[model samples]
Target: MTVALSLGATANLGHAQNTLNVATWGGAYGQSQEAAIFEPFAKETGVSIDTVTYDGRLAKLKTMLNDDGTVVDVIDVSADALNTLCKQGLLETIDASALGAGPDGSAAKEDFLPGALSPCGVASVAWSTAIAFDRKAFPKGAPTAISALLDTAGFPGIRALPNNARYSLELALLADGVPPENVYRELATPEGADRAFAALDKITGAVRLWNKAQQAITWLVEDDVVMAASYSGRLFRAAAGDRNIDILWDGQIYDFDAWAIPKSSDNKKDALRFIRFATVPARLADQAELTAYGPMRKSAFPLVGKHPVINVEMLEFLSTAPQNFQKALKFDAAWWRGNGAALQKRFAAWRARVNAARTDREAARKAKEAAEKEADKAAP
Candidate 1:
């Protein structure tokens, strides 16, 4: 089932003999990988890592892996994508023994968080999608919970939500008073999907939908929105430069990203070596220092300290920090893996209805204005 890579494609022309091709989502995340993972791994093992950027498209990964000559050795994938790929037999099942030991000589399974060690991948970092608000817009009282994000009367202003249904439905259910623990359980049923969409219906007109993580941050920065559902890391970076932007950790949806190798990759050995080297507690902590994401390994928390460049402490901004972690909702990737398609279809239908309603409203307003102008001309 393995696809062979052409030697020319993988051979480091002017670099080290061994090369590992890694795929990641670009931007700050990519920079962090270069500084915290790739460079250090190359220095240690002489494996020159070639980084590529993608939009986390599973189809692209599948196509590359299924082709006769594939170049992607390792990829950074979201938990749900990892689950889907693993189910489809697209990714390699990593050996826990191949993963290096923790500082105290604990096994990889024992070292990583409860759900971190999957058959296809190991969790890299813990991140969250939380509510971020502009301080100047909400000078006195800001949103304190997920409920407030949906409550137009309580917190009146334009709100931004991700165009996708992933976190959107979960946040709606939470706002409707579904307990964090029961969110995924309830979402499994038809009634639960109805309730989530019903909650979303209330704020459809007031919400500005954003497709990109940076777009959400931009809306908050330009005052295009009073508040937005944002990736915690994006908001942290924005807040670092602009104090006016702040994140509300309450009801944040916490999830992890993992490093997975394509089943057909030719450089599985080098990829495994890099994964083992990069995921060790100290290296994981290094990643956290470079970005706002929390380290995946429990042991890494003890090692995480101040930001490497910024003078601020990293713990307070991390999703796994005690105060922030307490009220957060740990995303259920299993539920998404099982019910995602059906729910996505329902969400699409609901969105179409909302768009139609908006169009109707605009049409009515325009017709009324036209009639008013015509009547005034006749009177004159």
Candidate 2:
């Protein structure tokens, strides 16, 4: 049986709208969240739900939304894309009052964590950037700090890091002796770029850059690399599967995942109801438990206490515990939206340069081998 909230006088039960189109990533998190929360909510409210998964949500929004106005009525977006959507006027501003306002006729926005609520969206989950390592490789204790990953001399192992400029620049800055608070400010200018690149160059030969979550995790499990910076949720999945992996929250970047309603959605009322229902503390907690992502609702904390993310007692063994959210940087999505194309060109060129170097080295090796063979034959 499907469980749903009552559409009494407070809810607009008369409309009988039976459908909502939701957009989210298609993964463990996506599937579980949809099944546990969205599906149940639909059953309860009589609002049927459909899903669309896009690997790159910002790009997806651009493609799916023709600017004729309406696109998917509801979207779950990362903080980075959420910022971009807000600027592009692609999202609808949420009214807290209508969303079960706070006491004394005021809205209940305070129940959520700071910065979780937005004019156009509200946070659905919190994910952190953290280190995942092979526990079997280091049974005594996992390296507990981000700085530890950068210390090639002390912690000898192949490391995999993300190729994205947003988090990469911050990690480079952090490794280069720039404090977390000063990372973005320094990188905001040209000089900061020079410093960050110089720092990154030191570890270039030791690091393998990865574009996907699974690649990074696989590198750790396959013993291809000993340590990697990866999405926390991915690590959770890996650990759940008994990969002998452990995560360290040291210097991990935390980001909020938000749920937004399109301003142009024809089903505005249904969309709002869906958002409200999906975000209810208990329902959101269920999603968090199944997916191992952090819940945005303060009320869900109790429900999520048993989840790995909220396992305070075992936190010392976790990767994200040492992560300083205060020092961790937030990606400037608006800046990226404007400059992404140019930056992508630069990254592509950089990758090509690396490939070219490898190609040249291989060609030289072949020539050397041919010369050695010719000299031996002539001597004989």
Regions of model 1 farther than 4 Å from truth? 1-17, 104-106, 137-141, 201-205, 330-380
Candidate 1 structure quality by residue, lDDT tens digits, 1-380? 11122343435643225777788888888888888888787666656778778887878767767874658889999988898899999899998888888889888788787678899999989899998888787766877777888898888877888887899999888888898899988888989988999999988777777889899889888888888898888888888878888788888899989999987777787888889988998888888988989877878888888887887778767887666776778888677777899988888887777677668767998999999999999994
What candidate 2 gets wrong by more than 4 Å, as runs, is 1-16, 52-71, 100-107, 136-141, 305-327, 337-380
Clash pairs for candidate 1:
none
The local lDDT score (0 to 100) that residue 73 gets in candidate 2 is 76
Angstrom error of the Cα, residue 354, model 2: value is: 6.9
- How does candidate 2 score on lDDT? 0.69
- Give the clash count for model 1: 0
The superposed Cα distance between candidate 2 and the true structure at residue 56, in angstroms, equals 4.3
lDDT values for all models = 0.82, 0.69
